[model samples]
Target: MPGFSKILIANRGEIACRIQRTAQALGYRTVAVFSDADADALHVHMADEAVHIGPAPVQQSYLNIPAIIDAARRTGADAIHPGYGFLSENPGFALACQHAGITFIGPSPEAIELMGSKRLSKIAMIAAGVPCILGYQGAEQDDVTLTREAERIGYPLMIKASAGGGGRGMRLVHTASDLLAQIRTARSEALHGFGSDELILEQALIDPRHVEVQLFGDQHGNLIYLGERDCSIQRRHQKVIEEAPCPVMTVELRQAMGEAALKAGRAVNYVGAGTVEFLLDARGQFYFLEMNTRLQVEHPVTELITGLDLVAWQLAVAEGQPLPLRQEQVQLNGHAMEVRLYAEDPARDFLPQTGRITAWEPATQSGVRIDHGLIEGQSISPFYDPLLGKLIAHGATREEARRKLLRAVQDSVLLGVQSNQRVLANLLDHPQFISGEFSTGFIPRNFADHSCLRPQVPSDAELAIAAALFYQASAQVHPASLAGWRNNASVPLHYRLGLEDQAWSVELNAMPGEVYRIQIASRSLELKIIECDGHWATLVIDGVRTRHAYRLEAGQLCLFTRPGSLRLTDRTQALVSSQVSISSGTLKAPMDGAIVDVLVSEGSVVSKGQLLVVLEAMKMEHPLKSGIDGVLKRLQVRVGDQVKNRQILLEVE
Candidate 1:
């Protein structure tokens, strides 16, 4: 085996930071490449040396083939590590690395090209005796032909784009009439996404679990499977939760899946780390799905349970090392689970959110690990995926791991960008997730309309007494008169205080024997003030036997609620409110991206949802839709335009 001295990581975030730890531990110096936006990023700071590649856009930086090759040449690194995304599975990039005499730490260019295609990969799987969904894989495709094919195959089949994964260019057909239209739309999307409109068909299972087997191979042709991971908890085909040693997996089923995966691996001569995915039906029958040629994002859970560093294995294998251990030596241990943290608002349909990370602190505990890519004061730009980090926990049992993970998620404190923290916290306490009976439809099937507690507003009675006391004490010039003012006042002062655009009139009447009677809005409120100092007033409200503390900030009363730390701001007008620009004929960019395609002239007739143009940002394509049925009045930019957040691209009239 030829060992490498130095390696260059061609990716970013937690995966880059993760691979560096593994390679450095094995006596390899790591080199990192960064874009202008990532100058202060965590991974860049973590590497031994860093290089400036290009601007913030991925195409100009991470995906730039020439820049990457130049970096490898300049750094004099022996090998390059493509971390998961951004040209990780591109055959051209792999071939370029090989031609430059630099080892690519992944499968060969041929293996990548074969397994990366959906149709060819399926053909190889079926030839190797792997069970597959009943579908068509021929070149002839049209409305009539596809409709007939769908009828023969069955209803509720999947029209999948043969290009890439991550739920894009895929459609579910439940009826014959919708088949043709869906196929055309799916093909267009696939063509736009993967530069290929070619698609295939697959029978969609009604109730199935998404299971995957992790496999590792060496240059000496030794292959080993490292058990299975259950990724049934997903939303829109994106995995939100993952676990190892699937609760429903049996020894016989594991062997069947493992051997099939091995055959698929050998068919392509796959080396380094990869994952073979499958859909397990309720009857214990499994069908082959697509193969991920790169290291998976959810590899932490597998490592937690198996006590293995898969990245280290990949590095060793890339250096022409043989398998150090046999398959019999691989043993599964305790249960482990991982939850993805993202910069998205669950309440707003999980829309992507971008801002500065003011505070990012997750609780540190034994057996619980957090793989984060950014730090405090870092910006969450709209140019990349919304993912923030992954929280993983391990324990002797599933329940123990669940409890620990839930605690860690609750204790996480993130400010600035809106996140799915509350949603994750609620999921942990859910009965279905705790029982491990969840399927791929768990999120949309249940808890879709769940409403979390909103920020509370302070009641009127709580603020009335504070206003009366403030006026009375301020009137007394001497400290002694203000101190004993409550006892000295004959007729109690009555005053009205405003709280959040509302008013509460209070009357404090002193009766015989120094007894104070308080009236607020025709309702008598009984309260005893135990202490009053500066801006704080402590009192108990009627019907609720609780003593609460209130703070007076800038002529407004504020109360803090427990558990959630919900604050009730009692001011007439808020200090600031977000303002959305409301101007007709002004087109705003939906995301922070660069203009990839301009499809309209200065003046063109357009209808609603018409594709005006296409924007490519964060490796995902977003088509700008026409807001109203009107004419394209103006074209402000052309192809390859660099735009900012909320920048106007064109005008419509």
Candidate 2:
């Protein structure tokens, strides 16, 4: 079989770049398709050829099957690689590629259609002798029928969209009263997310370990399983951390699960890369979840352990080749782990954050790999998934791998946008995780206090250094005043800075030879500047020398230290009027998104915590609630209105 001369990647970001790297290495010219927003994206520049698809929204760009196929046709590419998301699992996209005479590097269209619906997939799995959860996957999808089914299944059941993944369109109903509302919400999200409102109900498995097996197949009917990955460390039913060779998976259990996954794959004539997910209970029993018919986000950990390039295998299988290795021949070596670094705030219910990445620095070390699509000054839009990149580490043992990954995460520096880096580090360091005694509910159960997500306050020495740098920077702008110096020599230079929500007032007394005596609150300290350069400052505080990365932007100063990044607003020149608080009666949008629904109207009386509006952003719905008991005085926004961050949407009295 001959390899494709050119391969078009029908995705963006890190996964697209990842596939292009492997395809190009195998002598295949790579083509990239991008939206208007991604014209200057990394993947566009990395590919041998590029084409513009459409706009920023996924429906007009990445998810536009016709536009993607047109790009492949125009580029004369013989093959298309749908990297993980977007149209990766759409059977219609696969059929379109077949009609366009371009090879779709994944499972067959028949297999994808068979596994696309959770209900249908569960039926097929039962027929193949795979154990499935006890629930209702019937064809009756009406509200009455679903409500009855929920009652029959009892409380504590899950309402899952038949066509959904990544936690979207999923709701856990623990009571009778919440069933109907949750069903409606799930259906609405399902329609928006997967283009289908169909759903399924399952018995909520509490704190089960999410274990999935990576499988590969070819046209020749050969299939092999590539060990298993534990994806139980998750939030909102979405995976955050994944590790290969599950800690508790004995050799016997591994063989049993691997065979069952292979059985599931062969039942649907699965081809190329696919994953069979299962829910492993505490009693050692495992039940089939769903099959993902494409390469997964956590494939890198499996690749690292097996020492095989899964992308290369995907390409090879797409060329009508047989399995290169049999089941007995495949082997898993040392442990490997990967953590997804998303642009989200863990403290604020993990709300997705979008802004410019003013500073970006990744860990560079042997055995540690950083797969990302970030660049300094890049804008993180709210139009796509929040996943920025992945950080993976491999070692001879699990302990070594965890240690290396933790260190790498600590050393990483990302500024201007809130991230889950500190949260990840804390989770890894938790006693439960270190002992491998956690489950899908680990985050909510253990870290609900938000202690792990709290930001570290700067030390006194660091604060003194920041003040000294501020003084020096102020002096550089105006050379005539000798900055912060007074001829009277009796008064101290006063400066005010704000860090997060806390404000600090500092009085610095300039001394001879670039040294200063600084007083913050009641504490006094000494700091000496050894050197000053652009974004880098070397300071000596109390005879300790340290180098820090600093950036000044829009009346604010950011200091990047080993503990983490500190953003301080320079409020010295601002008037008291500028510090006014938001009006108590006004409710603002927390992030940029479109209004999905308005639950309340003007003149309506509402209590605290009453749902007022639903805003959809980053493909998830966020319900904005009334902060206090009051009457709705003004409803400023309606359904379908696009809102900006902190934009007022309603007013109460």
Q: Name the candidate that leads on TM-score.
A: 2
Give me candidate 1's TM-score against the actual structure: 0.80
The candidate maximizing lDDT is 2
Clash count, one per candidate: 0, 0
Candidate 1: segments with Cα more than 4 A from true spot: 141-145, 452-591, 594-617, 621-653
**Candidate models: Cα lDDT each:** 0.78, 0.88
Stretches of candidate 2 above 4 Å error? 454-459, 483-491, 561-564, 578-583
lDDT of 1 by residue, 1-653 (tens): 56778899999888889999888888898899999888999998888888899988777998898898899899888899998888899999999998998999999999999888888889888998888889876677666777777888998999988876888788888988788888987997798677888888888887689999999998889999999999988887888889988988899999999998998899888898999999998899998988999999999989999899999888888988887779999989999999999887665466676767755667689889998887878988767778888999999999998999988887766655667777777777889889888778888777767763221234555454465344434544455654454555455666555533344556775433423467777777655554456334455455444443434444444332221111223333334444433335567776577798888897798777788888776556667777777788888878988777677888878
lDDT tens digits, residues 221-309, model 2? 89999999999999889998999989999998898899899889989988899999999999999999999999999999999999999
lDDT of 1 at 180: 81
**What's model 2's TM-score?**
0.95
